[model samples]
Target: MGEELKVIVFSLAHEQYGVEVEKVRTIERMQPLTRVPKTPAFVKGVINLRGVVVPVIDLRGRFGLPEADYTDNSRIIIVAVKDMEVGMIVDMANDVVDVDSDNIEQPPEIVGGIKAKYLRGLAKLQDDRLLVLLNLEEVLNKSEIVQLEQFGE
Candidate 1:
């Protein structure tokens, strides 16, 4: 057995995705968002989380998927990369699983329509299920993070 990675799993369009738990700040129910003009379409906008304003991106939109209406299961997953904390609007955030490091393998060219660049790897889970692990750095690159930081000011 290798090191265990605690992953926060979320779903988008019925496919499972995972992010390392340490990068997550908190997961919140869908809340009202203040839209920012001139930002990318995936950049849904920002939300007031507690006293801090955090930029949010629609995971579906980010992956270039067709837009869908929010529902009771919608959630905002607050993640930190470097010094910025941004929220990712996921269809549902409902699980945290411990995965063995050895179970992870390099991502293919594409998974669930998302490019491999934005993904870290694929985790082979029990019961023949696979979890798409996202590479946050590539998902929200430095330039984009800089753009989001401006909104926090």
Candidate 2:
């Protein structure tokens, strides 16, 4: 037996991805965003979240996947890495599961068009399903983390 990991599961382009539950602050529905200038296309904008402005990024765009129309299922997952908190837009966020740390395996070179650098590993769950674990620190690299921090100021 190994340490149990509670994961917040979300979907992007029909593929499943997971982030540690401890890293998630909240999950919100799609809302209007105030665009910022000079940021990358994936950097959607900022949203007023309970008096705090939070920067948002579209995971689809971040992964270089074709952009799709937002629907009722669209959600903004607010995740914190270190002192930075950012919202990640996903197709849907509807699950929370506990997985054994031992079940996680090293990620392949690429999975579903996303680069390995952005992944932590792949967790093999029951029923032969695989959950892609995102490396949030890598997803929001040092430079982007600095950029997002600026939005908070």
Give the per-residue lDDT of model 1 (tens digit) for 8-105. Answer: 99989999999999999999999999999999999989999889999999989989988889999999999999989999999999799998999999
- Model 2's lDDT to the true fold? 0.94
In the range 80-153, model 2's lDDT, one tens digit per residue, is 99887899999999699988999999999999989999999999887688999999999989998888788899
Residue-pair clashes per candidate: 0, 0
lDDT minimum window of 10 residues, candidate 1: 124-133
The lDDT of model 1 is: 0.94
Which predicted model would earn the best lDDT?
A: 2
Model 2 earns a TM-score of 0.98
Per-candidate Cα RMSD to the true structure, in Å, reads 0.8, 0.7
- TM-score against native, each model: 0.97, 0.98
